[model samples]
Structures are given as structure tokens and as C-alpha cells.
Target: MKDTQPADRGAAPTTPAPAVVTGKDAGRVAFAAFVGTALEWYDYFLFGTAAAIVFNTLYFTTFDPATATLAAFATFGVGFAARPIGAVVFGWLGDRIGRRPALLVTVVLIGVSTGLIGLLPGYASIGIAAPLLLVLLRLLQGTAVGGEWGGAVTLAVEHAPPGLRGRYAALPQVGSPVGTLLSSGAFALVLLLPKDDFESWGWRVPFLLAFPMMLVALYIRRRVEESPLFDELLKQDERAKIPALEVFRSAWRPLLVAMASALLGVGGFYLLTTFVISYGADTLGLSRGLMVNATLVAAVVEVGVILVVGRISERLGPGRVTLWGGLASAACAFPVFWLIDTRSPVAIVFSIAVGIAVLSVAYAVSGALLTELFPARLRYSGVALAYNLAGALTGFLPAAATALLKVSGNASWPVALLLVGLSLLTALGGFLGERMRVKDPVATG
Candidate 1:
């Protein structure tokens, strides 16, 4: 849907227009978004890493080894199932109240749930209740994260000068890699422990750290200014009464495009990292430590890719960069798995790093592209629903890969095919989204 001038809707403007944000304020907001998202993702990724390596044994001990791993992966997917609900709830809050308040609530929810996971008892200690509690906490995390990206992207992009929207949007996207680095690094360090100690308490250490990180994120997020566009909406009393409903009613096409644009970043990432970790360690007979370290290296590579690609997006446009990135990733899908199948430590790391780097080109620009797809009045709900819907649909990729591996007699080709399909879907999104982009009334800042 094309963006239109805000209608008066019979209410007279009450609040004076907010002062223009200085460059310094913009930088602060970007930093705050980065920090807040990084913390939230760190918590989320911790569960993924643990699901691959720890939870199968600890929480699903009643099942056989293979079934237990599948069960653990299922729990990981459970969080994704709850994300759309979070998106609707927080997206409404963001659209109705303010971006800053919605973000603050999300950070708190994610942090508390993650920390509680650290303290939770295992199946040995609590029987069936253990997995149940894990699922409940995961649902909370899903809800929090569902709300996190949209608000952060909306806030950052709204604050950016038109010419620099790509770079500003990429700043918060950096959090995914940063979060991966922190979570994977934490696991890498703790993996150095004896197997007994590592399984017993080491995994819990990283999760426990979420509490303090949340506090820091909260402090920073609270200080950041609200989105200028959202502020303008507030002054005009133009908030959508039911943003989720409105998005579906008038913005379904962009919503679908956004989901397609997001699938590879969400699905393909889990395939390359979370599922690959399980595949490498459990299936390929690779060292668990080696697999975790490979992801750590990939996380480092992704950070560089995002920074460089962000600047490139400013020149090439987000959609073109995203399209190119997706095509490249599709081309590399088979080779990535082939390299990992070699079972050499160097090859394993190289495979994951390269895979993530290519996919990251699209991911880095997604924030800018998604923001351009909807008007400020419905941006939060539309972006959150689209992105989180993709997340919910693909959250089961690791488990699906696990199942595919079994059905294919342990061949990696089926999984590679899955990545190729996801990449092409992403490419289609970038193509369509660019062609149908909504003009950003406030982007000129």
C-alpha cells in the first residue's frame, strides 16, 4: 500500500512537534538499539546452542538419544510459535504508545525468561515438569524477540537521514552476529570444561549472565529518544486503533514480501549454525568444541559482512544488495554442506563462515528494506508480524533438517536443497519489495 499524508481524523494536534534530533542523538539511538538487540539475541541464541548440545540430554532424558535431540529441537521451535503473538501484542503497544516503552518491556521479558532457564531444574531433578518449564520460558523469549526487531528497526530507521537509512538500519542488524559471537563464545569457553562439568553447570553460566546484560540494555534503551515519525503520529493522533488488524487489511502484500525477504536470514541461519552444529557433532562425528568454534568464527565473519554490506546498500540500494546476496547464497548452498562434510576442522569453519557471510548481505539490509515497505502508522505491527511469521514458520528448520537427514539416509543434499529454496524465496522478496516500495514520508530527516 502506498503511504498517504496522515489524516486529521477529527482530533486536533495537541503536542508540539519534537525538536529535530542532532547527529549525536542519532548515534546514541543506534548504539542503544544495537546493545538492546544484542542482549536479546544473546539470550535467544543461547537456547539454540544449548538445544543442539545440552538440552537433549538434560531435559529430554526420558527419550532415546535420537528422539531426545528431536524433542529438544522441538522445544527450540516452540519459542518461534509464540513470536507472532508477541509481535501483535508489542506491535500494538509500539504503534499505540511509543517505541521506547515497547522495547523496554520486551527486553525485560526476554532477560527474565533466559535467567530463569539458567536456574531451572533438569529432567533428572524435576521429571516431566522440566521440559514443560523450558517450553514456557521459551515462549516468553519468542514473544519478547518477536517485538524486538521491528521496534528497533523502526526506531533506528526513523532517526536516520534519508541518505544513510541503510547504514543506520544495519547497525541494529549487527546485533545478530554480536549476539551469536557472545553466545557461541560463551559456549566455546565452557566447552573447554570436562564433559561432566560442561553438561552439569557450564551451559547454565552463559544463560545466567542474561540478567546483568538486560539491566545494561534497559539503562541504554530508556535514555534513547522515541522515533521522530512515531512522535509525529502521536502529535496528529493518527495511531492505528488495531495495528495488527489494519496491517492484514491493507498491507497484506508487503507483509508477505517482508516474510519472504526474511525467511533465509531466519531459516537459513538456523540451518547453517544451529542445525549444522547438531549435524557436525552428532552426525558427522566432529568434535562438539570444533563445531561451536566454527560458529564463533562465522559470527566474526558476519559482523564484518554486515558492516561492509551496510555501506554497500547505501550505494546499491537495500533491495539490490539483498537480491544479490540471496542469489549468491543459493549458489553456494551445496558447496557449503560439501565443505562441512569433509569433516576437517578448517573446512568446517570455512564452510560456515562463508555461508553466513553471503546470507548476511541480505540480512544486513533487511531492516532498511522492511521499514520502507510500510507507513509509520502501521510500520511496527506490519514489520513485526511479517518478520516473526517467517521466524515461526522456519523455527523448525533444525528439526526438519534432522528429520530429512534420517529420511535421506543421512545425505546432506536434502538439507542443501532446503537452503537453496529459502535463498530463492529471499531473492524474490527483495525483487518484489523494491519494485513496490512505499515512500518514506519521514526518511528525509
Candidate 2:
């Protein structure tokens, strides 16, 4: 348990000293961050997967196939649209109150929203109401997860000793690929169901499973202590009254550049994971299971790469390695579509797996990199706003890609060009952020 006593500031109602945690306790806190992030993102990945493979036929049945697909992808992006709002609200809470409690709230909110999605009636049962309800729930999920990453990442990085901040922060980031793998693997198994049954109710299994997983995550999170850095701020009574505003006023440069870097990573990854499924299925006439399975294999590869990058960041510098990832993403953009065009499952899997691994290089240290971009006083708000701002931009990438592909008569050129463009921006942002990075004595900023 964390020390919550008020500090002795030489008067009545004095603020207490910061609670000190040992090295062993740091690992526990980081682990909690990892578990909660993984569970929340598991639901995130489930929605993305379902939107790509199943939601169109069920919720937008009234439209033609292409229109329905566009509608479904739009709905998938709606969650991202709500993320920045969540970042503002929760970023205030994290900066004002404490990182631990704020994170706990996000976990419960995401779990309830995701589980409810499993119970929603389809368009056949309720007409337009079905899609409306899905949009509402996806927005709620987006809000919850939008708040989740900053707090979790800050928790891990702040709790660790200064030297290993990258590795410890990366632990929570491992959740993204792990969640993607579980969601992908779960859907792949459910896809084995007969066609009629799959279209009917098979896809709900993963969403429903989120309830039990949330319980486990909540239990683990409860055991972790508050961030030592935040606690120190509390002791000094230096907590910002409006953390979001403070970040906007004092830290906008890092926030803007960081958002750009995150855009390439988030948008490019979604293009590969969510949009590729549709392109492979509709354009190439491939099996859904094959695309999902290939994603699963790539997800497995991504997990390893993220962990390795985290370790490597301890020596080579997080920002520099992440810049390499941006160049790699640009180089791989053409090949990603070219391999899928081949229509061979082997080539498709190889492309996605290798592409994701390169992307993981940036992702591996993203949490730490973002955390290090601002003063500890405003770290949570700064990073949360930057991260979710990127989410808001990229949330529509899949739908936009779908529309672009259709307009160009199903050509992959537009999508590849867009990715390369995003990657170039990411590289520029990475270079600027590294140059402008504030050097903190604790190495957390």
C-alpha cells in the first residue's frame, strides 16, 4: 500500500513527505501498468477486428456493400474521435488527484463499455438504433482508453529508478501487441464457426470475455502504489489546478511534435492492422481467417520486437531508435501492399509481420519518450493530450483508406503514398523532439 499521510510542512495541516518505494516495488507497479493497459487494449483490438470483418454486414445492412463498409469503418473511427475529450477530463484527474486512482477508474469504465457491446442488438433487431448504440459504446470505449495510456505509462516510468525508465515504461507498451494478438487469435478461432453462425453471434465472444479479464486487471492494479514523482508534487503542493491548460500554455511545442510522431505510429499501424484486413478480403479475394492469422503471427512478432527495443533503448537512446522505425515504416509502405497483392498467404503474412516489427521499434519506447517530453508537474496532461490528439487524427485512417482505394479503382498507390507521407512527418518530429528534449536530473522528463 502507498503512504497517504499528509506532509509535515511546519504547520497545522502540513503536507507530508513523498512516499518512498524500493526497487522491488517498482517492478510491481510497472507490472500493474502492463496488465491494465493490455486488458483495455484487448477490447480496443476486438472492436477494430470486428469492424473490419463483421460489423458492416450486421449494422449497415441497408447500404450497398461498399457503402456499408465505409460506414462500418467510420463507426470504428468514432471511438478515436472521443479520445481527446477523455484525455482532457482524465488528464486533469491524474494531475490533480493521483495517477493510481485515475487509472483504476479508466479500467472499470472500459470494461463495462466493452462487455455491454457484447450484448447489443444487431441492426436486424432494432433497425438504425443498432448502429447508434454501437457508436455510443465505441465512443465510451475510446474515452476510457484515451485516458488509460498516459496514466499507465506515467505510473511505470515514474515508479522506476531513473536509469531503466525506458525498459520499465516499455513493459506497459507491450500491452498493445499482446492485446492485438489475443483479440486476433480469439477472432481467428471464432471465425472457424459456420458462416451463418459467425455472422449471427460468434463475434461477441471476445467482447464478452473482456469482463473477466477486466476483473483480473482491476485486482492487479489495486495492488500497485502511486507514482513517486506525482507523490512528490503533492508534497510540495505544486499540483496544477488546471493541468491541461498548463500543458497547453507551457509545453505546446513538445506536445505538438510528439503528436505528429504518434500520428505516424498510430495511423500507420491501423492502416496495416484494420485496413489491410478489408483490402486483403475484398480486393484480393482472400480468406478472413488467413488475414487474421497472419496478423496474429505478426502480433506475436511485434511483442518480441517491442521488448527488445525497450532493452536497446537503455543504450542507444529511445528517440534515435524510434527515428529508425519511422524510416523503416516509410521503406516498408510499398512492400506492405505489394505483398498483399501477390495473394499468397505466405507473402501476406511475411509482409504484415515484418512491417509491424519495424513499427514496433517506435512503439516500444513511445510511452517513455512521451513521458520524457514534459515537466513532471505536467507530464500526465501533456502526454495524454498529445497521444490522444494523434488518436483523433488517425482514427479515421481505415475509413479514409477504404474510400481512397475505391476512388482510385482499387489501386494501392494512394494508400502507400499516404503512409510514406505520414512516416516522413514522424521522422521529422522525432528529430525535433530529440533535439528539444528537456534533460531532467531524474531522467523522467
Residue clash pairs of candidate 2: 6-16, 7-15, 7-16
Once superposed on the true structure, which residue ranges of model 2 sit more than 4 Å away at CA? 1-22, 441-445
Task: Find the candidate with the highest lDDT and give its number.
Answer: 1
Question: Model 1 — which ten-residue stretch has the worst lDDT?
Answer: 13-22
Pairs with backbone N, CA or C atoms under 3 Å apart (clashes), candidate 1: none
lDDT of each: 0.91, 0.86
Error of 1 at 246 (Å): 0.5
**Which lDDT tens digits does candidate 2 get at residues 1-445?**
1222222224233333444544777888988999999998899989999999899999999999899999999999999999998899999899889999999999999999999999999999999999999999999999998899999998998888767877898999888988898899999999999999888888998899989999999999998888877877777876767888877876788899889778776888899999999889987899999999988999899889888889888787777877888898899989888988899999999999988888778888788788888766677888889999999998999999999998999999899998898887777777776766654444323
